[model samples]
Target: MNSELKTDRVFLEIFKNRVQAIVEEMANVVLRTGFTAFVKETGDFGTYLLSPQGETFGCPLDTGYNLSLGIPAGDVISSIGQWNEGDIVICNDPYSTGGMATHLPDVYLLKPFFYEGQIIAFGLCFIHSSDVGGKVPGSVSPSSYDIYQEGLRLAPVKLYEAGVLNEAILRIFLDNCRIPDQNWGDLRALMAALNRGERRLQELVERYGISRVESGIEDVLVYAETRVRQMIEDIPDGEYEFWDYIEKGPGGYPVRLRCKMVVRGDGIFLDFKGTDPQVRASFNIPTLNKQGHYYLVPALIRYFRTLDPSIPWNSGMVRMITNDAPSGTLLNPEAPAAIGARAATFIRLMDVLTGTLSQAQENKLPAAGAGQAAIVMLAMTDPVTGGRKVGVVQPICGGSGARPMKDGIDGMDFAVGHLRNIPAETVEADMPILIERYGLLPDSAGAGTYRGGCGIDLQLKVLSPDTVLTARNMERMEFQPWGRLGGKAGAYGTAVKNLGQPSEERTGRIDELLLQPGDTVSFFSQGGGGYGSPYKRSPQAVARDVRNGLVSKDAAYEQYGVVFHESKVDLDATQKRRSAVYGSTDEQQSFHFGSAREQFESIWSDEMQLAIGAALTVYPLALRDYLKRCAMKEIDDRFHRGEQVQAIEVAEIMAAIHRTIAAL
Candidate 1:
């Protein structure tokens, strides 16, 4: 492979860039024709052109999440039957199509790029539409219990037949959605993006010859594969396990997720067999097959490349990987399971992977970061305009975890990259809400030798009578972003209504409460965890943070063992505090995390969750909710009766009880 790369360095570089250009053109088409403000303004869609063999060669360089296109597009092409000219297949079946479409509202369209009646490649596009028919205004919510409730599931249906749009299918979709025009327009834009990819591929074939272009695709994969292997080989191989939590799902129970990976030589296997079984709520991952693993591979690869930058990002990097998730786990759900907002699970997956890799090579990885991205889509029915208004109040994100030598980036992009926050001015112009404030939260950042970057705070006042806040991927409330080594944990996130006026803070629920005039909503995002001991942090850094208004002078003196005098940090006083608080290296005592939450977490391990999930599966979500409450009461009674916590050895039963307690 290296010899091949050496011989074709010039050719590979040119071919790679050319394929990238094709994807860029595809994205441009989508942006030009897209109707919704989310897609046009924020550019939340993706396009890719793959080889007939199901390898992503070229993808959109800007806009949308490109990594999303790689694995799902490959899975879709492989699932279909013999292809022909003008065959466009549509699929939003999260289970059948893998993590391609995490939920129903994300529509995925794929068309075979054919030449001379021979299918040579495929063009694919996906968009998060304004709506799909569901119990809620939008198709997603943490609490939704079934896919049917989430929205319509199109299982590889033909959106276009013999080069013509399927009007009947279009009508069905339009009738089911609240915003028909926006949905139709987004669908058309996706189609246009697909056509652009097809045209670009055809042009490449015309210029470079069909066979050469095909070879180019294969060559890109081969080249990428070799580079990835070399990169893996550079790292010392070993088995590593890491666990992270999604504070709570719609069911109000914290979801415990674990990842046990074996990195051997140039290959890796992610074993999720011990993971918690599928939940009754929409938090379940709908992908039935191993394809859901694709969602995690890009993130793992990205993390790996951060250590070794020479690795190429084409399909080859992860070709040697295998995912062994149990059938009923959240990572691989069974039939009839609801999976409306599976992105939350995916975020957990990324976090676990990051943690595992970090454990394997501490110096090569960053500390645990603000893993979950806060995605809130605010929609309102304006009585004055008589039209639906939608806006993104904030694309909330937390600070990145700190590194060995450097502090983590604040409000960074996690999982899929390049997702930009919508400007406050745009939200006001397009929607009925007025954005009161949008800025970084002072002192919300994780404090350590290298402090984690801070997350953002957003305050919005409702202007209309009815405003629906459809929030997804908001986590780290119960379990703050964890730190590594000797670092401190970051602050938890919260959402409150009627701020400072009989307000209630909500951690894991979405509601459509009527908004009276002067009602305000305040949102605070989670902070990323620090990397090392706060006392070890440079005094100058703390002084800078104080001077910049990021850390309060009092906080610097107390939490961070730094001192300030007359609005300025006193270097000698800070040094004295640091030495007194932390002591000398030899005399310093190791920080101990006691049993404050240990016993609580013991009952919520992966093994126990499966038993609880099994019982819940036998009943519908509503009945399960009642049973869960009873189980928690029983546990509380037992606890009060002087029962030893260790005696509760029934993992599943214990987990079930813990789930209920956490929910309550």
Candidate 2:
């Protein structure tokens, strides 16, 4: 181990805050000068200061999104061959940079900071562009089959060489994308943010001397690692495994995700060995087989924060943890696999991690929330100019799961850094749509002593003819978010059009829809899972929820065993009703996955998933996706066709799969 630096605790704390302030300043610059609605309104951007080794040393906690916190740029930097003082490297390729940029729409820029003719640090910035020239207007579609169909994929290339702009590369972006001016403006803002961070880093070096500044950074990282390791050691050493499924895949098929966590001493290992193979749709996460920890780091930081609020936020926090996912699985897809909609799978993975840990430490973890971001994008023709106007209507999200000590937050999804919803006025001004209704869904939260958060209900009326719509990350439609310790499961959400009319249409998670003028579209997000038993809730709390329009009177009485008479809770009657309903004490289970998941898992059990995964391992890597798809199709066909399938039938199917594998 390296010798401990002479820096004191006071100096280290001060320097940590100073570095965070610099990154915050960098984010402010980008937000103030950015061009697209996604960047300014939705805040889809990130800023960070990276060490010479490309590990993130500092990131803004108050201003930018946390999705890019674990993006590693070491490979991207090294792939560029060499760098100069004014050079800026740009990349969006997931495979080349070890999954630094998960999708093509997120454009990343990196710049090196130099002091005394030696590179001291790097400034990194990324933003989700509105358009990058793809098969769809928004540059992302759930139906896209490959990366080539998603958008232009840029490998690590020099956007600026020795302070000289590369006009050729700039022209290529302008000529190919639908919104050239907006792309150019966002790119310039990213460059400005990088420059701002680089200048601030140099100033820090000048004030504290290069040696002291570098040592301070190293000390901060070591401090973070030590704190996290100590926290890991506290948890009882054992192996905890969990399995969950995605309700819909590329062709409306179900995809399964399994996780096994082994905590031994100060080290933790996360293995995704029995996860389903990569899908044909855009839901695959290109984690580059186990090298990328982008999907695992965010939840770990959140977990560690509960233990030690002062733990430094940097790449070093993950040093004591290791991640492993088999190649060609949903977490680590091969080349050309569409990944534009990978966030759908990524958030579910977060739940898998949370669920696995909750098994060991139920008191420390909350239940599952609305596990995905329901982003609605609309493309319509301008009435006056007859030109296409494409923009995000709203990134609708749902509530958080209930905590041990408190209720979950209503109408907010905390998994994705608490992204704010776009105001209704902003949507009307940008697109030809009117926001009719936007509020919470009544009785949507899971029922428990401390209730889970409620989901949202949004209604939009189209004012333009032939308006096209694309919605991504729509999940929890079939299997409701699971609850813990006897808490009831939350309600699922849906998408429908032309409500209360003869031509009214209802659809499952859709890729695109053409709507005529005056047609209405509605989106209802899923609620979070509750934490504890519902019978233990106070009658006053249930009455308050009913009065506030968050819970229905009937549901409150039925689910919570609360008695209400004419808008008032009868304390004597409530106690008698609770006793009659629950009979002494409420029966509790480790997990309550609701009836939908229970029915689905009855046929597709954990043993069946493992057997299929093991059979595929015998085939060539290139053929695994195909074999897995065929096997899943057979299973889904029996259920979808309304055929009664028993355990014996499923066993026979597994036997047939093994036979096929042996023949191959």
Candidate 3:
């Protein structure tokens, strides 16, 4: 056959299916043979096939952990320098891998697929291991100040060389981790999956000539790029800017993220110029300035997929997009900036990108969601061995935002959709904990024509002493989820210990807490923001929601102005109430941020944020972190002390910051 025929559309699609099947089989092998609760029960693992140059060619699509499908392996490939048959390499250092592995707990393994004494492709897989040896038992904490405290940082190194297992490296890993046996078993499962992928890939190369297989990879990527560029061209060309903030960081300070997107013809540019400098906490996201990373591509990909699912999932999807996240900022933090809780920042970044695109595309996007992952980890002493055991009790997620024509999904967030929560039965059997109650929170969703989804409420009791609970990405406690197009904002999240008793303590965000037996911990995730005006909603729909216990009678009347008597909608009364509650249609506000955020933004306006970013740009990178803290502290102190500052006073603070940068 001619070269043209080998790279034809039909042949390229056939090869793509073959490669995808190989990765799916690899994932199945890991799922069945893995030894940890993360892999076996939660399915927190991913498998992919890569080209020799380290671009992802194929990955499973129907699985929950599809989040890792677009991760690039080029850094690991380049670090190895050379590849041989039957050799395998491993690494989990986010900095060394250009943020490919994300955090140190995610252990990655790669093996080269050889054909006729030459490397044709590579097989790759990663799993969130049980432990990697760090200051915390789970090896991840939001309070961590640097990477050193996160976990064991593994540079690119050969775990197996020429079919021989590197025993020395294995010993080093086993000696450091808290659960040595669990880690060893999980690593072996990864190796087995890679071997299965290698066998399947070699078979494909033997069936179709090696040259045709190689050409098909190139054709698939080119096709994806063409499809995505066309999608970008469909969007109106203009510059759109959106900004969001994290409520609190490690030092009890809020951080802002600014995104300015420019769409011209068939390409887009994302510049995070006014985002806050990187904090000393683990909330930083290590994007490494790469556009292909999911931190930059997922939001766009999600939008495109909603338009057309036929678009191929590959690395080339990011080819039409470019990013400029200033170094030392939260998006592209410098080395040693703790990234253990990077997921918190990543979820909010997705929201900011969605918000910007919503402005540019107006009716084409949905309103903002909860915008946080809300992961909960529990560590307790093993009753049999008296050894510490750490495991994820619940990877809890909030609701998705309401769509233009439909309501948001209840009790689910897009970011953590790939990770399944551990079943209550498994949690009770494996750990010394009792799940008291778990279900959706009522009357939590924002009220609108198309109401947003509700968040979750979980209550658990500790059955063992010395249990430590660490929950990351607990946000929206101070600022509720913002609404769009005259919709009302959603409720915020909260964490409380001993709910009804006098010892009830509200811990908005838990880093680490010690509990005794019989202590109850309750957590409530934030709901999604609403879309459109609440008065536009049908009274019948409100009555149904009230009957189903999702909406209370008081909220239905107060928020939506829909009167319900004995679970029945009073049509005449509803109309009169809505007209009186909301004065006039023209006077209705388009967006509602609730009272907390509105109050905060009045003091810290968008212009002030930009001025602070510009002034910090002139300071040395080493001093930027300190200067940012000082500036925010001044504002935070006055805001908390119930003192109001005029706009002129805020501008003077900005001028003071500029003078400090110049003096240095």
Candidate 4:
């Protein structure tokens, strides 16, 4: 592969930059011309340059919509069958393109680049539309159990032929979605990005020959694969295991995601053998059982880039990695399975993969960050048009986990921080809303030698009546972000209505709620986890936190072993508190999962979950939900009766399920 290219290292480096510039220009065009808040403000979209073989060769330099490197172009590119000059195809259904379009909201379009009547490359781009015709106004709802309930599903079909617009397809789409004009504006922006990529790529072909351009694409992929494999070698070769859970499954049970990572020589294998089967909820990830699907390899992507930033940012980075997630699992769900809320599961997958890497790296990695990112939206009556208007409020995310050498970032974690936030002024101007509070939550940081970043707080008051609100990806409320190496766990998140008023009520993990005029709502993000022991943290650091309003003086004395006198640390009092409070703490403790997960795991351990999942597998997918709930109810009753229920087997559980269903 190396010798066939004939392109030297020096020339390849320059060639890589030139190709990357084309993609960056494409992205810039989309940002400037987009209509929806998701594209214009949140930047929930991307552009990529793909070879005829469907490998991503060029992508944006930064991590904004960093999905360009991981998303496959082959399925979508080939789904249209044949491509002609001045032709474009589009698809929004995940099942049609084989996971190419993750969800219906993420619409994909591709334009093939032709040289002398032969295809040489392709340009692809996508936008997360605000509405795509679903049961709800925004096209996404937590209650959706099937794909049909989510939104309109577009199969691989041509939206343009011979440079002429196919108005029929466009009309069908616009008629279904609530926001037709805005969706049309975003679609035009994507077209602009694709055309720009095609033109810039043409200039590259003219500068270098066509053969060199084709060879350059293949060579760069090889280059990235080699570099990624070398980084994988840094981790000691071994089988490392890790697992985490999603808050709600098909029947609202906590679904577990387990992985066994085997690193050998220059390759890494991710074995998701113990993962739970697909449920009837929106948490399923449509991976299509593809090897090293982009959704499955984010931890590897982050780790490689963190160690060596120069690795080529393309699909080649995942060339040497392999995935073994069984079909029907949460990571590889079948068709008609709801996936509107997969973004929440996407964050969890990254956290779970990072957990496996932490074990392989000997706990050198940073502790867990807030693994959840909430997309808050509001729907109100439009004053001018007298129709329903929906707009995004904010993409609220928490802080980064504390690193071994440095403190975590505040009020924004790295998981989805690349996506921008909506400004308060923008929200107020777009809808009848008032921003009450938009800042970090105090005392939300995890305590350790290096403190984790604090969580985010957003409070808004509705000025109009009949206002409805929806918050997606709200998690870490029950299970806190875990601390590492004897550190204290981060604070949990919460949502409340009419805060500070007589009507104050806690709304934990809400799907949708109605708001009256002048009613206020507050939402929070889970704080990041810390690294190392809190007793080892410097008193000066604790005092600084108190002064900054991030950590209160009382919390400093209680959580951290720090004492203060008149806004200053008292060394003698601090020493006494350290010995009296944290002296019994186990410094060797590798993780602090807070009381929620610890207490829950005591009864519903890994063995218990595996038994339940395995027993339910034999039954049909449709009946598994009812059977699982029944089996769990028996365990629940037995455990509550102080029966120490470890003696149950799959056969016994099945028998109990039958009895429960028969009685019903």
**lDDT of each structure?**
0.70, 0.83, 0.82, 0.84
Error of 4 at 307 (Å): 0.3
- Give the per-residue lDDT digits (tens) of candidate 1, residues 414-516: 5635566778887777777778878877787777788888877788887776677766767776677767667766777778786677665553444344565
Cα RMSD to the true fold for all candidates: 4.1, 2.6, 2.8, 1.7
Query: Clashing pairs in model 2?
Result: none
Candidate 2 local lDDT, residue 129: 87
Per-model TM-score, in order, reads 0.90, 0.95, 0.94, 0.97
**Could you tell which candidate, 1 or 4, scores higher by lDDT?**
4
Model 1 spans with C-alpha error above 4 angstroms = 2-7, 69-75, 78-82, 308-311, 502-508, 584-599, 602-637, 651-664
Candidate closer to the true structure by TM-score (higher is better), 3 or 4: 4
Query: Which candidate comes out best when scored by lDDT?
Result: 4
Q: Residue 87 in model 1: shift from native, Å?
A: 3.0
Tens-digit per-residue lDDT, 505-583, candidate 3: 9986888888888999998987888888989998888888888888999999988899876758888899899878776
Better of 1 and 4 by TM-score: 4
What TM value does model 4 have? 0.97
Best first by TM-score, ranked: 4, 2, 3, 1
Evaluated against the true structure, the overall lDDT of model 1 is 0.70
- Give the alpha carbon lDDT tens digit for every residue of 1-664 in model 4: 4664568888789888888888888988999999988889988888888888788888786524875566766777766767889998988998888887878999888899988888889898889998898887678887788999988889988899979999999999999998899999999999999888888888888888899988788888888888888788888999988888788655556777899999999999999988887777788889887777878887778788888888778888988888898878888888788999888888888878888888888566888888887888888996667877887888889988888888888988767867888889988888888999999999888988999999998899997788888888888888888888888888988999999999999998868889988899998787889889899999998898899999998889888979888878999999998988776997668778899888878888888887887777777777766787677777877789988777357558777677677699
TM-score of 3: 0.94
Best by TM-score: 4
